[model samples]
Target chain A: MNRLACLVVVIGMALPAFAQDARKSGFDYMGPDTQAMQKDDLANPGMLSVLEGETLWNTPTGKAQKSCAACHGDATQSMKGVAARYPAMDDKTQSAIDLAGRIIQCRVERQEAPAPQREGRELLSLSAFVGRQSRDMPISPPQDAKLAATRAQGAALYSARMGQLNFSCAQCHDDNAGGHLGAAPIPQAHPNGYPLYRLEWQSLGSLQRRFRNCMSGMRAEPFAAGSTEAIALEAFLMERAAGMKLETPAVRP
Target chain B: MWRLLGLLAVLVSFDASAQTLVPYRIENGAITQSLTGVKGDAAKGRAIVVERQKGLCLLCHSGPFPEERFQGDLAPSLAGTGSRMSEGEIRLRMVDSTKVNEKTIMPPYYRSEGLERVAANYKAKTLLNAQEIEDVIAFLVSLKDDTQK
Candidate 1:
């Protein structure tokens, strides 16, 4: 009986590890057979936004008369591993560019098309489709010297004080984490679950929106959208949450 | 001249008292408290939860009452919290919830007494005054529904 009990205990201990390995091997983290059973929302006819992006991707505009399809080919193949390495720095521009910014660049310079407005459905759909390509791939960013420096700059920004309230992001996200600030337990502010659907915002938003919200919370003037500062901050956050699995389109409070 | 001086003194004292009653502000715009109050009405409490300009409690917590949309799923529900705690305990949590859990994201509705420096505009006030604290407490305690699981 003693031996049997010990064997049961050992099996119980190993259960979590087996479960983890199963998850690593493409099993759904939430439950087995769930992903297979789930319908693809993107494929739904209601996903007109994606259809619009597909059209825009193929359409030609501007002086160059080039379409995104001319250079990138089919999105599923070319966009693989793309979203995992966003908010990258461009040496020539001496600035950081998110996936949206990169798409805008392709539209303007490569295709000679008008830059799509930030936060527009064109950009969101394109980004969403691209991000979905790397759904199962682990996030990996190049760790070259320049990228490292940019990540460090973002780290500094994360801890720096701003606004009239004089609170740093670290204060709420780090120092006072897990505690309720009213009715909400402060989440770790991990970037693993980004491009999320926030109940408060009532729409999908990038990590940049959360950063802006933090600034507002601190009563600081928010940096402009697509600013290098916001990009660098994104780099820092993505790096900080390096090992965590990506949960894009996660629902948030 | 003496009568005028006495009247001025009375007016100054009244102003000082009013300032004392004002809430304390953190360097952030959030208000702090010392103790949660007990004078709140359930309706007012509900308003505070959903108020975009005030508590915004629905931003993080789901409660038994489901009428409000956009309830957060991350934090624990507060539907039966009144049963778990006394009114005084609830007040304490409201005033300075950080005292219960240091890592809590919840801001102190009171107890900004030891804050080193606050914004100039908010220096005279606490996050929530004693009355506001009581009001919130009253509201939370009223959430008790014996049939609630």
Candidate 2:
């Protein structure tokens, strides 16, 4: 498993060979400095939020007077590999819900508490905490035997050209993955990292934040944070990243 | 009769300058030069080509830009395009390169036909306007090979 194979053939007219089965995460493409940062949990800036999330996880403030651990027990044991199976089909909603969406849902329905903020500070803390539970685990987002119609819709949305640029995700990420987008290497976008720290962002953030940034980069009006379109795209990304190791709280350049 | 003629004159002027949706014809992976009726501004074209917000050409295509620190290494360079391709071929490519290579990653900057999975908001518009297309063409046409530059 030579990861250097991914770096071959980038200079000439020849495109890099696609190893679709490799399941490479975006973190694999980061600079050594970034890799070092993410590898060190103590040094990673994202860990700030993870620490906050740990405290939040232990504190019981919901109307039902229960913490995430009350029913689930210690997250280290109970939440292990949980993030790997997200954007899952919510039995009640009957639609896909990512890790963040599922957590918000739990707050409302299970805990009988007020709806948590969408990508708010608290939510990000909790998401990063929960996501960190599955670090190094292989991603395997709900592989229901039945193909989801919503997944098909998600495929359409992924390929759709939006914004003033008339560019689709397929135009760049799919067709030209591993290609350079102005000195910036465009890695095959696997949503394995979330609550990841980005140099441009200068902080740890959720996948939804990155999605919004990309949408605006195309000069297109972005979908709302928790809208069906955003969720669908999330599901599609999670599916695309299946089998890749989760790098939650990963660092990026 | 004088007033009627004057009103008609105003209406005709408005229609002539209006930016209507234009149609393009593709034949054998090329669009012949017969259909285009546009004048280009190379200076403006230079700006458009480098603009990440709109043209976004730099996202994939590397070109001669000493001032800009970053240039892509994805698609072929646009530096010596004039020496390599005819204006007509360049025009066709810019409008819709997929006509020549269906699987090409380059977006059709000036066409809206036969595209599947386009966002609803941008359904009615082409990526670049006719004048912008002409400007880009003029800029490319002015690119005289590296020896000449």
Candidate 3:
């Protein structure tokens, strides 16, 4: 009788520990590294957008008669680590610039072309291709004094409350890290896989699109595409994912 | 006896309502049908690729047989995946891609629940039904050129 009682106590203690491990190992965030290795129907389809992006990368436009190739030749070599270093602070602008903003800057300042619309397919695809070149590299945004202030601004945006839902990014991604919003568990909004091909979006999309979605979820007015606030937030997210490998054009739930 | 009959009638009505639900046709399927109808015809699944729509299987995967314009360079092709997976396994993935990977961005065609926050009109319906999923499975199975097993 005493042995049976002792065994029951041991089983009870072991059960909770096992559950904790299971929770830790199970699919909660579905990080990019894991997604890249996992087999799925969407994986191949995501490449179609990449091919489109390649075409856009080389096609010239505007008065400069310059394409992306004009400035950055053979993307595979030139763009190798570019994606992993953005939402970087510009020494000239003294503000944060994400991959999209950088592309627009190139067009406006170098090529002298009109900026593409926020959700344009050409922009999304080009960004997707550039991001893909940096796949598997660790995120490494510059951290000098000029960027420190921007990083601080980004941190504030991450935790600040906005909209009718009154929920900040931290509420779903951090404070309630392992909690479920419904059937889907919330992931720690890592930017390692920007310019991802989300099944929900049914096409390639940028981190900025996801950010806008979160703001809309909060019922707050989303920041415009190239806004300083959005760029700062991107910088902050990239910093958070500093050590993680980049998996651009990744598939997401 | 009367109370028992009334409860039976209510249950029947609820079941009937469940069958007639219509959600978004992100893929090809009879939206008014149950989740069972969302399964694609494996034979016809290949023909459904419309660039932006359902036939996008090649976007991330490369099939064994290569079509020049539609093939993607980033993902592994799906030419002989039927040889790798069982019919039941393919069915489950086609019906709901999430069962395989929670972080997958793939839509759950067989999803019948957990959509409370979606637009109200789509609340009752599933993304796709079982029939469509099965059809897609059939098409995938046919892709196995070498039936080694």
Candidate 4:
């Protein structure tokens, strides 16, 4: 009898891992009209930023006056699958850095140009352009020992309660997803379609901006832009969204 | 005299904005004493629960509200709560659910302190005032129909 009980416990522990296979991206929860809009680049408004980024890629600026094409020589070939593997380790910082962060670093260090303001049109456009290269590819977070601590911190932050509402991200996205929160359906909170446009904003925005919006909605203080906590959360989200297809420059409502 | 009157008006306005809440006592996981000392109106309580910008109760709880098309499923259904629990028990849960379950997702409708990272505009403000808490309790205790579950 005890052996049977032990076997049941072991199987119960394994159930959630198997359940994760059925995980759905926020895309699945979107209305059909929005999905159709994402499928057609012509109809999607986010493509404008991607086109701007493409122009910026070939144009030279700063003291070096060297375009990204001069070093990388065409984003289509050199940048494929690159966005899928971020927030990767930055050698200088010895911490996780997101795709946007990496772009700012390159502009400052390699191009000898000043870093663009966070969430600025320049940054958003560049990120959207680069991320567009990895569309439809699976998210592939790195499996390095160095990134483990940051990933763990991110996971903790996802579950930690904050704000006057005392809501943790997991409580809504994990525990009660598919339910309605006053007319709006609570999605699973995947980070797959970042650098994507939100209908609510009527413009393109980053994942960090979304985080701040949610934190404020919960009546809590928002994490600073580019803070370690925000990066850590991004790292964890990418890992959680591992195997999900990228939807860069995607449209959402 | 004008200066003195202006000073008094400023103090009064400041006091109103500060929102000094009523006092109450807790006993055995329940606030046996009422915060406002006056009985609450059940009709107004029902309206508050359903309103999106007020109690926000429908955001995380389903109840016997047929008109509400988008009730949540995060917490227990509010139906038949009066049949299962006493008035004081419900009042305590409204005041602060963390006292019962440390990790409850249900926001404390009446608590105003010890919260972390609260937004600047919302600091030191409870989700519901003391009288609002009583009104909600009055509405909840009236729901004695277990069949609604």
lDDT of each: 0.62, 0.77, 0.65, 0.87
Determine the backbone clash count of candidate 4.
Answer: 0
lDDT of 2 at B74: 76
Number of the candidate with higher DockQ, 1 or 4: 4
Q: Which model, 1 or 2, shows the larger DockQ?
A: 2
Ranking by DockQ: 4, 2, 1, 3
Give the higher-DockQ candidate: 1 or 3.
Answer: 1
Which of the numbered candidates is closest to the native, going by highest DockQ? Answer: 4
As for candidate 4, its clashing pairs are none
- Chain B TM-score for the candidates in order: 0.63, 0.77, 0.56, 0.85
What DockQ class does candidate 4 belong to?
medium
Please give, as one word, the docking class of candidate 2. acceptable
lDDT per residue for candidate 3 within A1-253, as digits (tens), equals: 6999999999999998887533221123666654653335354456777888899889998789889998899999999999999877666776677788888888888888998776688788888889879987988887666778777888998887554333568756775566544334567788877777777777777788888887765446777787888888888888777767877777777
Better of 2 and 4 by TM-score: 4
Give candidate 3's whole-model lDDT.
0.65
Which candidate should be chosen as best, given TM-score against the real structure? Answer: 4
lDDT tens digits, residues B42-120, model 1? 6766667666456655655667665665665545677777787776567556765655565555555654344333444
In the range A1-253, model 4's lDDT, one tens digit per residue, is 6999999999999999987786787888889999999889998899999999999999998788988888998899899999999999998979889999999998999999989888999999999999999999999999888999999999999998888888889988998888877677888888888898999999999999999989988989999888899999999999999999999988888
- Candidate 3 residue B65 C-alpha distance from true site, Å: 49
Kindly report which residue stretches of model 3 are placed more than 4 angstroms away from their true locations once superposed: A1-42, B1-149
* Ten-residue region with minimum lDDT total, candidate 2 chain A: A11-20
